[model samples]
Target: MRLAELSERSGVSTATIKYYLRERLLPPGRRITATQSEYDEEHLRRLRLVRALIQVGRIPVGTAREVLAAVEDDSRDQLSRLGTAVEALPHGPEPDESDPSTAVGRRTATALMRQAGWRFSLGIADEFPAFRMLVGAIAALHRLGYACDLPHLLPYAQQAAQLAVADLDLVEEFTTPAEQVEAAVALTVLYEPVLLSLRRLAEAEESNRRFGGGS
Candidate 1:
């Protein structure tokens, strides 16, 4: 398809598409004529991946480039590396940081968790660190004075639980319960450090942004 058509289909602007091409974020399209190029499915796929990383995952361009490179490599560890990168979504500003000690917000969130007698699911702990991060985010919010009202956040939790169940069920074919539990624990430990490190780095980057030092 033509650049105009690609841009319209991808919901990205023409200039942005050109920028992506210049950055080599998008693969080179076929040069159909001296002044014309035609993009194909590969280009569309690359554009979608870039959009997911940039728009949905909130990853920075530099990091996304590295991640895309790692995922595309033919090395044995490429899948694992891609999995890790997928889990490293940008967490934007912590809502807890806004007002961590409120009775109806962050604090309320914690109290509700304790009341619900919730235990960290071992099934997910080993496979996805987002569970641990969610817990940490809640705790951090409580510490920062936000009232984590259980009632208010219950809908979000319910939706998350539904998604978790679906995900677990989907993966049941790949591993047994015992193996899943082990993987969950391993994933949690492995991802914890990565999460902390990335968060620190993000903080520094955010600081630079505030100080007019970041591009």
Candidate 2:
């Protein structure tokens, strides 16, 4: 299709599309004439991916480019592609290993993972900022008077591991590495809110059943 049609169909402004082209975020279209260019389904798919990463995932352009590069890299295995996608997602600040609170949090996180039998290495955790964020969250919960101990948190980790397996199964449905990466990102970024919303609803229903006057 023409540039206007591509923009219209993708819900991206022509100006932004031009900018993406200039920035090398989106590849150049097939030149039909000296000035006219045609875009195909692949272009549409890539545009959607770029938009999702930037607009929905809130990834910066440079990081988005790197993520795209990783996704498009045919040399990388499925696990590596998945890891790259996870790395590109937003994360909190890295926790200080020397800080007593962070140290406790790391131990708690490590214990939870070990109890759940989740296969992760300390090296992987150290490289991923989100791991630190997870630990920070546990520590913060403890500070906020919540039960952040291993026994209490193990159930959550177990459930998360189950969900991760399901997520991987879904990713396997896509034949191509790019498709798998896109599916992983979309599943993580888009469905996170859906999952949270459902959890909140479940909590409300449970509370109402147990404590509401209707009970």
Q: Which ten residues in a row are the worst by lDDT in model 2?
A: 117-126
Runs in model 2 deviating more than 4 A are: 121-123, 213-215
**lDDT values of the candidates?**
0.60, 0.82
Q: Pick the candidate with the highest lDDT.
A: 2
Model 1's C-alpha root-mean-square deviation from the true structure amounts to: 14.5
lDDT of 1 by residue, 1-215 (tens): 99999999889999999998888778778999998999986677678777766665556888667655544554535335535544554433444434434223434445544554555433344245454455556666667667545775677677656655755554454354333432332333344466668779988889989996767
TM-score of each: 0.46, 0.89
Q: Give the alpha carbon lDDT tens digit for every residue of 1-215 in model 2.
A: 99999999999999999999997889899999999999998889889988888887787899888877777777888888888877777776677566677777888988776777665645577567667788988877866678899888988877887888888898789887788887787677766777789899999989999899555
